[model samples]
Target: MAKANKKDDNVVARNRKANHDFFIEDTIECGLVLKGTEIKSVRAGHINLKDGFARIERGEVWLYNVHISPFKEGNIFNHDPLRPRKLLLKRREINKLEKNVQQAGHTLVPLKVYIKHGVAKVLIGIARGKKQHDKRQAIKEKTMKREAQRAMKI
Candidate 1:
């Protein structure tokens, strides 16, 4: 088992809408390499994974649209907020994601970002885009689940 960091236990950013908007097929954990300033920014909980997605380019996995804000006290050496960052994954994992994403409407969405053992990691999931009606169905199902839980409590 991995030892959890005591202080940064909570998530920095999560695309909750991703769950509602897409059907998640698989999940993969990947390490992100960042500059010192970028790490500082992430450690401070200044990140947005809302519109972030992962892509395979040139046989490598890259995360796009993931925003890590500049350090509060950073100088000229601060990293770019929207720079495309490399994702560390096994070659086998990269091959799998590339295959699945080639299909129509299938994508890799970034679900959450958090600090694990003082390292920044992104939790990305393979997802298929949902239609408008499907989204409504998901909402209806969620509402029923919430109602059932409330009734159980009562």
Candidate 2:
């Protein structure tokens, strides 16, 4: 079977702080458990991934703090904005994430949420917290790179 590419057209929300506050080590894709209007709201690009995180609870992966806006046209079936969504992942992946998270300053953070193949998916990354000096160095390095690119053009 061939897998179809479903690139997102409109981005609902992005966790800009994630890149700045944490050094992302690895990322994994997980399916999201959504309700009626939730899928529609997400497809419309009305969701937020900032301050969202994934954690294993009772042997299951759950996402917390992410917001999916209610459907404009939805009435009684509108999904809650702050509801915790279950993540679909294999047992091995769950164990690996949990183990890695418990080591040092590692954590699981969701980077984005979008619809793919008529289903919702969350992109979660295993990250290590960055120190104050690390963030400053990152900004300096980024600025230097931009300067180099500009100089090369002229």
Candidate 3:
């Protein structure tokens, strides 16, 4: 089988607010432990990562508050819309994340959920909460960059 292209990943959902509200320091791709109906719903773009987060509990990384809408065709077999899911990560990586997260203001936020080679995966970021002033500065910088690009195009 041919390998999937990096740019061709089928993104299920994204948490735009995560970038705006947090200063992302690093990103890691990890697999998700999802059920049949849950994967189906994800493939249908019924997932929401807006309020999703990950935490290390009892030596395991668990994803919380991710909403994967129920599959339309699924009746009793439909999975719950919001359920705490397990994130698959290596022990060393988990330890690193756990350590970094223990620092003040640091947290794990799901950046995006996507399908790679027919497998469900999530891109999670190790981030620190941004202050209101930092958010405003980011917004100003973004606006200035946009204007600069527009000027160059003219």
Candidate 4:
């Protein structure tokens, strides 16, 4: 099935810093392997993707540092907040991503977590780290654009 677009409203969490710290080259949405309580927590918008990242390990993609808060009524069955989760992606895509990430300064980062058709999905990006100068330039451009827009409004 085709992946959902960026404008989808079901987004649960986003890693805003990823945009500022890395240049996203490509994006792939993969299904999540979640437990009962974990899904409940995610549906409740209790997920944090700020520190999350993806790794290709043993021919599979694994997600780390994605926090899914425990379900309030789960009692003893509440899921762990920081457990590593598996991501479902095709073998070909996985291989390509692995190859790209093996290069210097390239990494896999989780861009966002969203619900599509009632199923949880994560949008992972193949990204390259930005230099300090590049980040400063980006910030400068953003400020300039903002100032220009504000000047236009008056």
Query: Each model's TM-score?
Result: 0.89, 0.90, 0.93, 0.94
How far in Å is the alpha carbon of 52 misplaced in model 3? 0.8
Candidate 2 has what TM-score? 0.90
1-154: candidate 2 lDDT, tens digit per residue: 9977646553455788999999999999899998888888888888888889988898899999998889999998887799999999999999899888889889999987766666788889999999999999999999999999999999
**How many clashes in candidate 1?**
0
Global lDDT of each candidate: 0.89, 0.88, 0.93, 0.93
Please give, for residues 28-66, the per-residue lDDT of candidate 4 as tens digits.
Answer: 999999987999889889999888899989999999999
Query: What lDDT tens digits, residue by residue, belong to model 3 across residues 1-154?
Result: 9987778458878899999999999999999999879888889998889888999999999999999999999899987788799999999999999999999999999999999888999999999999999999999999999999999999
Q: Report each candidate's C-alpha RMSD, comma-separated, in the order given.
A: 3.0, 3.1, 2.3, 3.6
lDDT assessment of candidate 1: 0.89
In model 3, residue pairs whose N, Cα or C atoms come closer than 3 Å (at least 3 residues apart or on different chains), thus clashing, are none
Worst 10 residues of 4 by lDDT: 3-12
Candidate 1: 10-residue stretch with minimal lDDT = 4-13
Instruction: Report how far off residue 14 is in candidate 4 (Å).
Output: 0.9
lDDT of model 4, residue 74: 95
Instruction: Indicate the TM-score of model 3.
Output: 0.93
